[model samples]
Target: MKKFKCGVCANTVYFENFRCLNCGHALGFHPGRLEMAALAPGRDKRLREARRGPSSPMVYCANEAHGVCNWIVTSHPDSGFCDACVLNRTIPNLADPQNVRAWGDFERAKKRLIYSLLRFGLPLDGAPAGKGPLTFDFINDAVTGHLDGVITIAVGEADSVERERQRQAMDETYRSLLGHLRHESGHYYWMLLIEDTGRIDEFRHLFGDEREDYGAALERHHVQGPPPDWSLRHVSAYASSHPWEDWAETWAHYLHMVDAIDTSVAHRIEPRSTRFFSGTARAIRGQDAYRSNSFSTLIERWVPLTLALNDINRSMGHSDFYPFVIPEIAVAKLGFVHRLIRESTT
Candidate 1:
């Protein structure tokens, strides 16, 4: 996420902030401009940018009533919900306080995912040649997965303890709401960019043939864990189960890498020069991972930075921030994702 400041006082604010801490000005994220705008009351329950005055009438997304969204939309006839909230097809019951909180967590993570999609210039609505717009279902007692164009997430995933329990039960190294969303959305985009675009041959070459029976592959994976040399070929153990999964896992990691790099750069966090790991760490200052066409540059900066981060986490008695390693094969897959995204934008 990019660093934001209070337009009123220039004090630092965050993406989730609804009010500036320093100046007490109301803040709302303008999705179209992709910036946090200081808000002021306008006519008829509308808001205007504090800096721009009444000319810019805006209204908070309808989800604001539930205290889950802080995005704003123009006060036009058809603009009630923001771009992100409009994708919701179903939200967990809000009558229960716990469900509300879980939904909040899901929305927060989903917004971050949406932010990355916007940054990459990907079609949020699955436009142009897509089968339909992408939608989301935040439900309970359901498995998290993507089908057709809708992505369903089990609300329990938002509970840290429950998520961790699931992770351990599944023998996974890492798991989170954002990770689930990113991984599933990868499936949605696979339909659009790979299947719809007639690039299945290329995808098969990189990620094996998708013609393999997914159910049988998953059953076999459950019966027998990933091969001992899985790390040499796949990003995660589960990824080795199927070609589609491989694509999703690699795509999720790609999003993770780019987002982490972007956040580090925005916060001016750079890896310090040290002989402990080899030569000087790559300079990430002013680097924009989303706009860059070079996948190698991302890997170069990501490796050293993750090393420094893992060391910091170790010093604090925490596990590695990034637990997975990107083998050469995974790098090629990531590069393919990068190319697909870049080509789509053009």
Candidate 2:
């Protein structure tokens, strides 16, 4: 995420900030401008830019009433929600305070996911005209997965304790709400970019035949487990369950790498001079990973940076910041995703 500052007082602010700490100005993110704005109150729940005055009128997204969104939409007859909130088809019951808090976590992660999608110039509400519109459902007592265009997230996943328990039960090294969102979104985009665009032949070559019986693949995966050599060819063991899963897992990792590289660039973070880190320092020095057309450049920058981060995490006695490795074959799959996204945007 890009670093933000208060437009009124120039003090640093964060993406989720609703009020500036230094100047006490109300802050709202303008989705179109892609920046946080310092706000001054206007008539009838409207807000105007703090520094620029009342030229542009804005209103907080309706989700703001629940304290889950801090984004603003244009003040107009048809605009009441920000670009991100408009994608929600259902939310957990807000009457329960526990559900309210958990849903807040879901929205924060979902917004970050949406922010990355926007940065990639991907369509949020179903582009290419004929495809189903992308939407989200935050519900209770259901498995988290994607079907058609809707991504369903189990509300329990927002509870850190329950999420960790599920991760352990599944024998997974890493899992989070954002990870779930990115992975499910990968499924949605596969339908759009690969299936809809008639690129399945290319996808089959890299990910194997997605035509394989998915239910059988998953059942066999659970009973027999991934092949012993899974890590050599896939980003994670679960990815080996089916061709579609391989695509989604690899796609999620691609997003992870891009977002990490983008944040590193935004904060000007660089690897230090050490035997493990010296080789990659120059690769990331001035590059913007999101706009870079070279997939090789992203991997070059990502590897050493992750190594350094892993070491730092060890110093703090925390788990590795990134726990997975990208093998050569996985790199090829990720490259396919990179090209697919670039082609869609161009």
Candidate 3:
């Protein structure tokens, strides 16, 4: 979330701006350079020459053709779509008009997710044969009308008003597009982790035996609520529904910790002391390599900062910004998550 400028007029811009409110310059995200570019067709014919740099070859998101996003592609990638655009398995129905607005929100949030993945050096690949590239399908029910097995994201999740209503109804503190990305990534990573012998047993022990029947577990969770003491074990009430959900929840939390700590460090918030687990907050303030660095160093910064931020959110009449408690067991699980990310990158 670094500051950006309008390449056309030099005015500052946001990551989501399509046209410079100041100069009306068409904008695109260049992933290779990790910067936004302003384009003035018929005005700035020298754009290609202006920004031809060695480190990051620049391009633009193809979705800009549809007028949905204005992010520039920083890399001269083999693929036309940027990292965020590539993950869209299903987009909303734009013909409905309202969906056009929803698509915009989805794109912004998806970009934020891409930012984190790129920052962390996660992999993004096309789906296997028959699955197609990690492509998105922005369509109405008619496109998937006959499919029973396919999961369709109700475009409504893209709507802020609708999403906020759902969040309130569910009594949750933090809900955002980035959160959804982290959660969904949990499912994606399952394919990677379940194959590993070293990590499989520990994951099973904490998340419940994945061997248990998933459909049956869902049915049971529906008919009978999670045990009243579910919080003592699971991070969220919904997580108690199944081991798969538990994994997703934990994965999302891991992203949360990593990103939060990274931002804190970027802002230069120093830790009070360097005791075990006391550095989480301080490390974030200046630690550029939050993931590869030791978790013990991070705990010092994270624990205190999480507490202070939570209190600030409550002061504003909101629920605690983070609702889950990180007990010793969860801490161990987070360590596993860190290891998994390290293993994946290596």
Candidate 4:
């Protein structure tokens, strides 16, 4: 996530900032401009343009009434929810106080994921006949998260303590609401970009055979554990369970690296040009990750960024923020994601 600033006060703010601390101005994220703007109150606390120009007034999404979102609807006032929230197929019954709080927690991570997706300029139109449109369902579930036509997230994942416990129970080095959303969405996109398009053969070549028996493979994985030295290529041990899983896991990791690297770029946290961290570091310099034609350079820069952040995380006595490595083969898979995303958008 890139750091945001309050346009009114020129003070550091956040994407989820509800009010500017210094200026005490109301804040809302404008998706069209991809900015967090300080609102000048209009009639009845409605938002006036913070930008110094002729402008039309804006209002927060309907979900803001519940304090569940802070995104502004830049379109018609009757649009109700922002683009992101509209994809929600089912939300927990907010009548229960626990469900209300859990739903709030879920929205924060969901918005962040959507922000990254929009910035990448990928497809967000969703699907017709329940086949294409990406939707999410937050409810009571036995699973942490799962994706079919809709992604279902267990409300318990909203609690950090509970989520961490689940992570440890599953032996995951990293897991979070955002991670769950990104990972599951990978499956949805796979259905759209690969399965529906008849490109599974190419996908199989890169990841492995998705046609392999998934349930039996998962049984073997849990019984015997990941192949020794799974990290040599797979993004996570769970990825070794099946090809479909590997693709989803890799796709999730791809989003993770890019988002962090995008943050580095936003904060101007580039490496010293005089010193190259690795052989490809020089090759990666100056590429706009959001618009770059090549994912090769993107991954090259992401490696050093991930390492630096991981070291910093250790210094703070926290686990590595990003706990996986992209070996040569893994990079090849990520490159396929890059090309696939480009293909989808264009």
The candidate that achieves the highest lDDT relative to the unseen native structure: 1
Regions of model 4 farther than 4 Å from truth: 75-79, 128-130, 272-286
**Residues 113-176, model 3: lDDT tens digits:** 6677677666554233122223344444422111211223456666678679977875565666
Off by over 4 Å in 3: 2-13, 19-27, 37-59, 73-80, 126-152, 168-174, 196-198, 268-285
Residues 243-320 of candidate 4 have per-residue lDDT tens digits of: 988998989988887887777887888553222344332423555676778776676677677778888999999988
Model 2 TM-score, 2 decimals: 0.95
Q: Roughly what TM-score does model 1 have, to 2 decimal places?
A: 0.95
lDDT of 2 by residue, 79-145 (tens): 5778888889888888899999999999999999988898889987565646787899999998899
Candidate 2 colliding pairs? none
Error of 1 at 187 (Å): 0.3
Off by over 4 Å in 2: 74-79, 127-129, 272-283
lDDT of 1 by residue, 74-138 (tens): 43338578888888999888899999999999999999999899889999776677477889999
The stretch of ten residues in a row with the least summed lDDT in candidate 1 is 273-282
In angstroms, how far off is 161's CA in candidate 2? 0.7
Alpha-carbon TM-score of each model against the true structure: 0.95, 0.95, 0.78, 0.90
